[model samples]
Target chain A: MGKNLREPLLKLLIEQKEGYISGEEISQRLICSRTAIWKHINELRSEGYQIEAKPKAGYRLVYRPDRVAPEELIPHLSTTSIGRAVRYQRSVPSTQSLAHEWAKEGAQEGSLYLTEEQTAGRGRMGRIWHSPTHSGIWMSLILRPPIPLNQSPQLTLLTSVAITRALRKQTNLPIQIKWPNDLLIHGKKVCGILTELRGEQDQVHYVVQGIGINVNATESVWPEELRPIATSLAIEGGRTFSRPELIGAICGELETLYDGYLSYGFTPIRILWEEYAGMLGQEVTARTGQGSVKGIAKGLAETGALLLETHTGVQTIFSSDIEW
Target chain B: MGKNLREPLLKLLIEQKEGYISGEEISQRLICSRTAIWKHINELRSEGYQIEAKPKAGYRLVYRPDRVAPEELIPHLSTTSIGRAVRYQRSVPSTQSLAHEWAKEGAQEGSLYLTEEQTAGRGRMGRIWHSPTHSGIWMSLILRPPIPLNQSPQLTLLTSVAITRALRKQTNLPIQIKWPNDLLIHGKKVCGILTELRGEQDQVHYVVQGIGINVNATESVWPEELRPIATSLAIEGGRTFSRPELIGAICGELETLYDGYLSYGFTPIRILWEEYAGMLGQEVTARTGQGSVKGIAKGLAETGALLLETHTGVQTIFSSDIEW
Candidate 1:
């Protein structure tokens, strides 16, 4: 069977979602042999699409696997730019590394690299990001923004706003953004954003934003050590959400926010970011390499640096681990 | 006969610089046959080293090629860190590209990628850097600085100071730094520096400083359009200089300046840069993408941006071409 027949067959199945269509009907619609139809059905099954083949009834898509496959996500994606050219992988070491490689080879501005499982997922400061299989969003987005190198930190904050807004639309639970790039819900981290940039002094060549979200993972999926600090959407809401729909929402939100950022500047995004930032006006401690800084988390600077008011003065924290 | 024999024979020739060493004597000293010694001499000649051979008089070293080979440059290098591991290439697309690749693969700090000729050399703001064969220093140095992303432009200014000081020590010609990263002699461009960096918001992964100096090119060596604006050391000084020694001096000066910048801060380097800057206090027009700003070139900011005092106000130019 030709590879081109799979999409047409998928379209036929989706169009006839009411009931199963006969093999003769499918063959007539797709202009292929019954044997070829069966081959494509097996291929779709191997790709984690559950198809029930009865004796009288021909075939029906019984269940769609919880994967961010291009076939599953592309149809639901509403963004015109982001996630348009998706590089879907079943398993990889890190989507950020792959995205960096592709960006070096001149990947498009809005190209996305997504994976089902990350063998060596990484977070900020060389920490391990626990990316379990088929239960979260493990993706990296490549953006070529014509901004100064100093303004790159603001992208992380802007991405935090986008992710938080996307999640807020999907669930009834409250979403709050931690200082730099962590998305928390109910006082536990549910998402992490790591933004890496490569460029010269004045201009940015490309920025890779790697985001890992715990969407559908249950309480039991997290390791013992991480259970106290981490929680997923399923654990908080007691339901498994559609990973494709969630990914689509995130991409659309990010694209809209990113475009606004580039057009009107960081002022709009900064305002939105502060609304979701739960740390502002609260007392917190930032653990830096030098020492610990205890202060009132005043707000974010226009450049997206954390402005903390301590006893000494106002300190601008570029990077640090936060503790309330 | 073998690649190993070339180095031993070259070592013998250097050791016996004042006199010719016979093939039989070289074979006895290095445990190789006379025919093998002759073959290695032919290989050395193919590599652009001029060797004179007379019947029964054996071979003598006549001239060393103006190539930035590891063997030629490493012995003269005095730096403890910079240019420690030199990856010499006869020809490459661009040393910056190669250095970026090596840095991505975890190349050590201070590793250098040097090329004799670049097929696609790059300048600032997508300009074409004319790199001819064996007439300039076309190299990139990798640095891993632990600083904020905003402080990276200071490195470019620091590197400009290093190159100016290095050239000033080697020659009596007056060397002047033009605002950001151009080194000029007699009001014409003699060298250019391009600094590229990769990092996150707070920590830098690596920085590739690509420096190209027009060292030994004659007036005719430059392209017709570039002859008026571009000049080389050989053209200005009326003599060819030793490229290896100049490269060694630049590397040593850069390593010293970089170490000082890391330990103390950008203050020392900024002071040195001001001393070498000739554009300060002069009226110039900065041709930026937005528009042109005509003002007196005041000085550099602590962050290394060019400060211009126009009629309206003081403007900081992040990137632009200067015209006086």
Candidate 2:
């Protein structure tokens, strides 16, 4: 009734910290009857919310399922624009495609599309991105920056820096950003960012930044081939983290950095990115479509290209797969 | 019958040169009954195809409607990849959006979308492109080129060169390319090209090139504001031209130029573009988002950017509206 009053009911239950919220108290807070409150509580219980209900003690939330439901995440998300307008789906092929369609249909600049799992998710150059159900944070954010076409790569770099800072602040694991779009924990990748641009010849219409993080996933989430190089926060930190909380923290950090990027230019983001970068001065090979370039990693160019000190000279890589 | 035999039926009628094909003979050629052939002829007559039937004689094709139907264009088109797979709409808002959606849905690399008219067509920088009904060529072509992101502007320049060459060869009027996106007939804009790129950070997935040419539109087709600036081939050349023929010529030229661009690079197309450029040595002011740059219009950069010789120095303009 009334479009399922479970979200507000769940919000009220989460707000009550110390004790139980009586059925009558919930009815008064939500402006509903006692029978309606009882029904909602039963539905929540069926959905894996361990709510204890007693005759005198009323109702209390004991535990919540490990799900990134909007009802659970909305209460924790604190942002002015980044996560304010969100489209959450239970499962999808890829949030990137959905975000692109929505962006073309006039989705707001900071709209976010969150999915519990991606069946046919993609990485850079059409690589397969493993996104199992209810195990990680798989989402795409739509950004409409009034910048030139050549500078769009900076948005991807800015996003990596934001996510790396968010993960660094949330967990004790040492998160390092491998140029240009990976987050590693002790040399194993914990997250990846793929930023796609749709625009005219010289101006960007919108950008879809797809960020996938193995937050609460364990080692079992990775396939056999990826076991040696893939990792998650739970595997590295030896403890599970809240997916909703991590999503909120990432949205917050991204909003701050994105605002700074728009106002003061990319200098601030570039500096933070250099600090988070872990492969500077290391011998590496960048495999591109043309060939391979082996060199010592120097830094990032002004336009966010990877700068390499090759034997010939300082080379700038626009697209490549890094191997150390 | 059999999905409207008008296309093949029209082809049969056109192949017979100076005389009429007997009704009995037509039925044998098309493997249809004589009554079915008569009914199809009536249907074609109702759709503005003038067929004369004489006593003891057969039907003779007298006149054809001035519509760019696929049935009318397919036989004349001679391209290997371009215009091979086409989607035609009677009316649509914009072919650009439709081509973009189709491209995302795995439409082939050389897919072309054509519309009889665009109710809400768009030009560069989100400007309005007036596309009246059945009077111009409004189409979009999808191309998946394996080129880097910075080189995308060359596609737009290459398209301009192709369209200018086609127009010059078809009509004897002096057709010129106004830098970046517009085609001019004696200094009045006649055609416009808007090339939109959709891709990841460093590589291109596909490019949708929207081309709109005012082929047979009369002077009254333009609004009062655009009357002084806009011109059509019919207005400039003092006679109407076939829209389908122009569309076929454009696709043929574009396919040849695009193939050369992929194999031999942008030098050939750039040379042709410079020859058709009307404002090369003229004094012009480029109004950008930041400010205006007044200079002598020198030429194009290797990357297809407009080069301007200002009093300060040579400035390369990526996006701007030009004023003389």
Candidate 3:
């Protein structure tokens, strides 16, 4: 049933690569298929894929959806995954939630979870993130680093550097990583990271790094409130870029940073981070649970802690909400 | 069946608290269950409850197993749980392993796990712990702390103070909290802590604290190889201590320490830890995955990261296998 219905449609498209195949030819090739091919083609078009099919000419591949495709991406994909194994969804509540479930089900290292939009996406401090359907890159990567639980915080800092590097290296647009996990393009946020982990008492079992990047999105696609603070590559560069290429670049950068952090502490990554980090050695305020501490950011500590020189002495901030 | 089994057993041992009860009286009080009473008594004896069945005097309750009972241990339990709810097993491969499964099954915060003998108990650095059946407190506490994933290492250091305080207050035996999470009595290992967390992205869903304390083990029971390095409470105090009491005390202390960390930051617990920690201010060397660092153990920073004064400068030690 599956092979016969699509074989004629495939052959017609292959023969007439210039344009669409007539419904009569499609019907004659399979002998029981013109309507079947039309139905299946409609389904494909609904997935943001621009399939131009006319009454006489047949079908034309006008636009391919700018999403991650395994066949097209895997060859150029570097870093042995961190995304090689993938589960893709057109829509989901959040990539982070599904990644945790997969990790619990014994999903191995290098598992990647991708979704078109997050219905209940959240940023650090429980803030809601504006994730519109098919306008952003929403994905989570699962990794089992051979490190203790105490050192997991460094992973988040390291991930931020990787995202910053990828956005810069893969595209001509300038990017800067804000303190914690915000990715900024020319002083406006372009992406954010949320790192999660699961483990057994002091030993880290796995980590899920969720990244959401605003790409190919119009300024109007964001809420009336977010336009001032957020921008997509399409908005900044006047053209939309391929999401799969961006994903490939980020995952490759992340795996490289992970190797550096694992083998040789955070020294090398810190140097790379210092180059792309915003607000370093600048006066900023961090609102932790207790209250707020306004101080000069003194760069990162050796063990990957954010050091802030506060009025009450050099108060080394380990974990908190950073406000510039 | 359950009622008949419990009532007769309770009635037979009501007045005969201090000494043994005769087997015949046990059979008689059980009424339609003379043979049934004998079978139940055998079951009770196997649970490490001391039942002396003297000649014609009947079965007496000489001793009860010194471990937390889900019934008796529930009410006096304090703290927002973190282990207020209880689940126990007589023998299990590992409490941490079982707890991970429970967490997957949506185990609530304060849900606890305990086992009498851990056939495959584990410690930090992937080492095996000597968990001789009913001779120590082998338990795991489930905590759902709402902190960022990276901030979890502080919870490990915070759990150490709780264990140390509970050991001192309940057992009246002084114990030193080793850096990160190890309990030492008279400079010999007696207890260890392993903290695990579950989360996705920025928010931490849960943190499970697994603690093992050697309460009633004798020096002879200690392996000849480990005798020089490890000592149990019985060996240190020259007497057998109650396991249930120690477990209850630890739970109570954990709740308090957790409260302080969540509300007031790690400062309160870090200050208290400074008082009980044996590693602080001492010249020591620690082996982390990255490399070894030798330095004077300063106090913990605000984020629970260990501050070590090495030859170069004050270095923050996150996770390490101590070589003191």
Candidate 4:
């Protein structure tokens, strides 16, 4: 049997979902032998697809895989450009680092680097992100936006909104965005977004957005120190979610928002971000390198900077760590 | 003698400039044979240094080299760090490209990439920089500054001041800086600077400052189309100048000015830049991608943007091409 028979076999099983289609029917439709169909069904089974085979009843599609492999995600993805080229890795040091290298080597915009596990995952301010094996979405998307350098921070905010919307749709949970790009549920960190840009003053060459989401990690999976501050979807919802479905949702939402941002500027994304923002209208302390500013988080500026109404005046924070 | 005897031989020639020391004296002082001393002197002569050698009167340093080789330029560089690590090349695609690659490979700050000729040199906005063979200074300096991304354009302005001051000392000509970083002598371009940066919103990885100076190009060396707008030092000053000396002066000035800008602030550089600015207080048309703005060039703002007083209001030009 040819290696390409599995896709056709899977498609036949999906098309004839009512009853079991005989092997002779699949062979006649796909122009292959019954041995090829049997081999393909076994390969599909190894990829985590549940298929029931009988002497006369043939194969039936029962369930799909929870993994984020291309065969599983591409069929569900409805985006135009984003996630068109997805590189799946079982393990990597850092998706952001690999995406940066691929971007340097002239990788097209919307190329994605996704890993099942990250050995050296990173967070903002050189912090370490806890990404266990196959328990989270550790991925980076490469984007070449035709925008000025100053407008880049808006994309980070836009990504946060995309992620929040995707999670809300999937889990029906109240997912809120922390200022700048941290996804939180009940004031506990569930996801983190890191945006890195390379460019000149007037133009941006590329922006690599790395997103890490704790989707299926259990309470015991997290360290004792981080258990109070971090929570996962499985831990909070008491049910494991399909990672491939969530990734597809996120990519589709990101492509739509990215296209909107490129066409209409950052106004729409700013509104969406404020809708999901957790700190708006609340007093928070932003700790910067110089000092801390105690103020009420009003909204975002036109350039996506945090607008804080401090005691002195309305101060715009380009970058900082916020705490309530 | 050994291959490392050039510095000692050159030192002996410089020390006894009043009269030529005997070959026996040079050979005994440097712990090398007379034949080895002769070979080292020939090598120095081939490198463009004028050395007077005789059987009775051994060798005297007459003049330094016009080339910007490491052997010649390193000795004259007085900067603490800027030119401490120099990479000299006879030909390259672009110094900026090479410097960027080196910076990605963890090159330290103040590392320099210099070439006598560039086959594929580039300018701002994807323009082609004219870099002929052996008649100009084609160099790029790698810098790792601890500053926000918006403050990077200030470094371009600071580099312009350094190059202008260095040329002022070398030629004593009426040199003026066009808006941004073009150096003009008598309304013709003698130098052009292109600054490319790699960074994020709040941190810079590195900045490659590529400077190309028309130091010794004669009138015929320039293309017929560029003859009216471009002028070289050899044509303007009626004599060839040493490129190594000019490079040394520029590096020293840059190191001092860079340190001052980092420690004190951009106020000092802004003041110096205003003094040498050609379009300040003059009516000019700034052409950008969107449109053109005709106004009187007022001064630079604190962020190094060109501030122009137009009929509507004072407009800050982040990037534009200026013409009178």
Q: What TM-scores do the predictions have?
A: 0.80, 0.79, 0.78, 0.79
Worst 10 residues of 1 chain B by lDDT: B40-49
Best by DockQ: 2
* Highest-scoring model, TM-score: 1
Clashing pairs in 2: none
How much is B224 displaced in model 3, in angstroms? 4.8
Q: How much is the lDDT of residue B27 in candidate 1?
A: 88
Candidate 4, residues B59-125, lDDT tens digits: the string is 7888864667799898788887898888888779999988988888988889999887899998876
lDDT tens per residue, model 4, A1-324: 497777777787888866789988899988999888888888676544688887777778887657777887888799888999889886789999899999989989899999877889988756798888778899999999977677788888999999999999999888999987799999999999988877766678899989999998877767899999999988888898989889999999999999999888889999999999989999999987658999999999988889999989999888788999
Off by over 4 Å in 4: A1-65, B1-65
lDDT of 3 by residue, B1-324 (tens): 544585568556857657666666565655646677777777776656667766666677877766555765666565566666688887899998898778778899778898888889888766888888778888887878877666777787788888888878776888998887888987889988888767643467777677888888766655799889888888888888777667777778877778777787777877888999888789889887668999999888765778889989999777777767
Of 2 and 3, the candidate ahead on TM-score is: 2
Instruction: Please tell me which model should have the higher DockQ, number 1 or number 4.
Output: 1
Candidate 1 TM-score for chain A = 0.81
TM of chain B, each: 0.82, 0.81, 0.81, 0.80
Docking verdict class for candidate 3: acceptable
Q: Please provide, for model 3 over A1-324, each residue's C-alpha lDDT reduced to its tens digit, 9 standing for 90 to 100.
A: 464564455545656656776777767766766667778677656555567877667677676566664655576578775678889876788888898889879888888888777899877656797777677888888888887666666787898888888888777888887877888887898998887777743468888888889988888777899989999988888888888888888889888888777788878988888888888989999977558999998888764668899878887676677888
Model 2 CA deviation exceeding 4 Å by range:
A1-65, A311-313, B1-65, B281-283, B296-298, B311-313
Kindly list the per-residue Cα lDDT of model 2 for residues B1-324, writing each as its tens digit.
Answer: 664677788998888766888988888878888888888889777545689998778989997768877888888799988988999987799999999989988989778999888999999878899998777899999999998787788999999998988888899779998888999987899999999989986589999999999987877778999999999999999998998898888989999999999899989988889899999998999998779999999998987899999999999898888988
Docking class of 1: acceptable
Q: In angstroms, give how far residue B14 of model 2 lies from its true place.
A: 16
Off by over 4 Å in 1: A1-65, A287-298, A309-315, B1-64, B294-296, B310-314
